[model samples]
Target: MSGKPGPSAAAVLPELPVTFRPVRTRVVLLTVGAGLLVVLTVVALMMPSGGAQPWGPGDRATMIITGLLIFALLAVLSRPKVVADDDGITVVNLVASRRLEWAEVVKVNLRTGDPWVYLDLTDGTSLAAMGIQPGGGRDQAVRAARQLRALAEARGTGQPGTR
Candidate 1:
């Protein structure tokens, strides 16, 4: 018999499917900016004028510019990405990225009435894969969970009922 080692378990397992969805950074930035603007406007209105105008052209311009900046930031931050495959899963956080192997994943749970997809791992950990859900509805979240489950099954690591 040949002395070569047999195929490793990883090699026989199916490759994990990889998928990604960009987060909506603009929306988040816009929401934040609007909130800040409202607060600032309220504060300006509340303060005593002391015989002076509460807001001038410069102030208005600043607020407008700042609001625009906030919108842009939100748009950028909201751009969450999802990457899944038979091997593992990956999620791009607000400013960083993380990955997990299929073996490490315990189960896939789609939170009902939630805006994102959640993964429950064997280690009693969970992760949120965002950006794929449109309108923050349940349908999209369910679809994502199915996709993750399918990927896990392909790798022979998913729960029995998940298949």
Candidate 2:
């Protein structure tokens, strides 16, 4: 091994137990979902009953259900997040969550125009870290990627410079 010392963890790594998420995306999605639900419910309740097949209880219920479904979809869109601690990292995406030990991560990447950060695993597969997505805030995503990269380099079992 080279005699040169690597950067200290305190100097490059972020505080442990930190969480990252797409703030702007989450806010916008939740806000829009709530507004849409309210508007749909209001329209269903206030619709004039004039036609032969006038709006009935079933129709109103259907409208409400539609609104609920839309809101649920938006909730899913806002669910991506990553939690990192001394032991490992937990990544929660739209439909799944996975935990990885520091030694299992080889590199952290966030290329320009990419949707989110990616973790290169020791197993040869890459995992998308939707929590640090550029679509929500580019600068924030970059900072998060760098912090995660630093953590991986500091603690990963893989050889350094792989990032």
Candidate 3:
């Protein structure tokens, strides 16, 4: 046996206990992108003008650019997620990720006409939970929000697994 000692179980980090995300955000994004591409291809093929000039470089370039932009939008909108563990919670938004302890969190709520869930913090600042949106799968988002609140309360009360 080697003289080096192997890593012990005590040195390993416990897995985070909670994760919340939109149910079918990625699926909808991918489906839209693929569906757009397919429709575009079919339309291009069915163009009455059999001549090559109708589907020139300019037309192809425009389609490519439009598809790419749509995909980019999907990428941005699909980025948000929320995760919680023994330590605290991490909120990943469209363009930013913030980590905060349980004490920093005030509440999670969805306002009327709000596109997504909002996380109110103790510091008077609020973060958008873009991962939980009212569209596509409202039930899933509601469940996720409830789960997040329960997790926060459970871990924020200074008693682990007590709630």
Worst 10 residues of 1 by lDDT: 1-10
Global CA lDDT of candidate 3, please? 0.66
* Models sorted by lDDT, best on top: 2, 3, 1
lDDT of 2 by residue, 92-112 (tens): 999999999999998777777
Summarize candidate 1's per-residue lDDT along 1-163 as a digit string, tens digits: 0111123211232244556453244355557767876776565456554456566556666756776676556665676777876456787766777788877665555544555666666677777766455444444445555655556545535553431
Compared with the true structure, all predictions reach lDDT values of 0.58, 0.83, 0.66
Name the TM-score of candidate 3. Answer: 0.67
Maximum-lDDT candidate: 2
Better candidate number, 1 or 3, judged by TM-score: 3
Ten contiguous residues minimizing lDDT sum, candidate 3: 1-10
For each candidate in turn, the TM-score is: 0.55, 0.88, 0.67
Deviation in Å, model 2, residue 68 alpha carbon: 0.4
Clashing pairs in 2: none
- Name the candidate that leads on TM-score: 2
Cα displacement (angstroms), candidate 3, residue 103, comes to 2.1
> Please, what are the lDDT tens digits per residue for candidate 3 over residues 1-163?
0111123211223246666667587678767877776777566556555565566656665776777677778877777777878889888887899898988776666555678888777777878877777785776666566566655555564222221
